[model samples]
Target: MNAPITIDTPRTRISALATDHTALLLDYRLRNRDHLAPSEPARGAEYYTEQAVASRIAQVEAEAEAGSALHLAALDRASGQLVALCSFTNIVRGPFQACHLGFSVDHAHEGSGLMAEVAGAGINYVFDQLRLHRIMAAHMPRNERSAGLLARLGFEREGYARSYLRINGQWEDMVLLSLVDDRPGA
Candidate 1:
């Protein structure tokens, strides 16, 4: 397996999720459940349990080892609190070197640009280290904050899909966006 990646920003440290971080992840998810409900699907009771989080961490670690996914957490430098989560999921190699990105920031850290900071680092790793060609992100039409963040990350609007995903128990329309690695020979 590749060495764990860590990116230190001005205010936070973004590191690849590991089994040891399961408790922190569970705490962050539980604390932000209400804040994230509008944008995320409802989680089952077990989702908040330590056992489930540990299993998830193990699965994510396995996927990272297999080159299929990268899951990272942004933690506050001083407080050691999880501030955001970023994931490059469903990674496809060979000719289709791309992945779908999913992310969310803690409510307490919203509008602080921490998500952008961490996501930028994650994207760099995806492009430079992983040598992926494209990264795609989708957001509900009403999610202005996500749209703005994606724009700042240089993603272009690709299209829109009706009922692109189920969120909060209902089908949500999504605006699809993608960022292509334009570096030479990428």
Candidate 2:
């Protein structure tokens, strides 16, 4: 097993997703199914099962080892409950050191700045530890909250895409945004 990467904050801790996290992830997904459905692609009934989550955890772990992706889970400090998920996917090296960023917070934790804390920590890992050059994120134009969050995190709007992805069974448009590492040597 790979060593877990953990980042600590005042209210939460962000850690690399591991197989041991299967149960917590499964519970979080099942509990937030309806709350997250609109923002996510439709999933089959099997997707929520513990077995499926375990399989996904294994796949992500392998991807992390292969340097193609990283998945982080944010847990409440006090309760140790899984409260958010963040990922840097499709990482590209060589001349293009970048990846797509994706994240979501549990419904009960929304509007509480938990995601901001978690995402900040995760982005730091991507740029500092992983040494990625850029992180791109996209959200539906209607998702004002996500737009605001990305702006606050220093991601600049790049463009708009029509029918960018299939979400909840229909094609959805997305506003593209990206943040480049501006530190020296980045």
Among the numbered candidates, top TM-score falls to: 2
Q: For candidate 1, which ten residues in a row score worst on lDDT?
A: 1-10
Candidate 1 residue runs with Cα over 4 Å from true position? none
Q: Which regions in candidate 2 have their CA more than 4 angstroms from the true location?
A: none
TM-score against native, each model: 0.96, 0.97
TM-score, cand. 2 vs. native: 0.97
Where is the poorest 10-residue window by lDDT in model 2?
A: 1-10
Candidate 2 clash figure, as a count: 0
**Tens digit per residue, CA lDDT, model 1, 91-136:** 9988999999999999998998988998999999899998999999
Summarize candidate 2's per-residue lDDT along 8-98 as a digit string, tens digits. Answer: 9888888889988999999999989999999999999999999999999999999999989999998899998999999999999999999
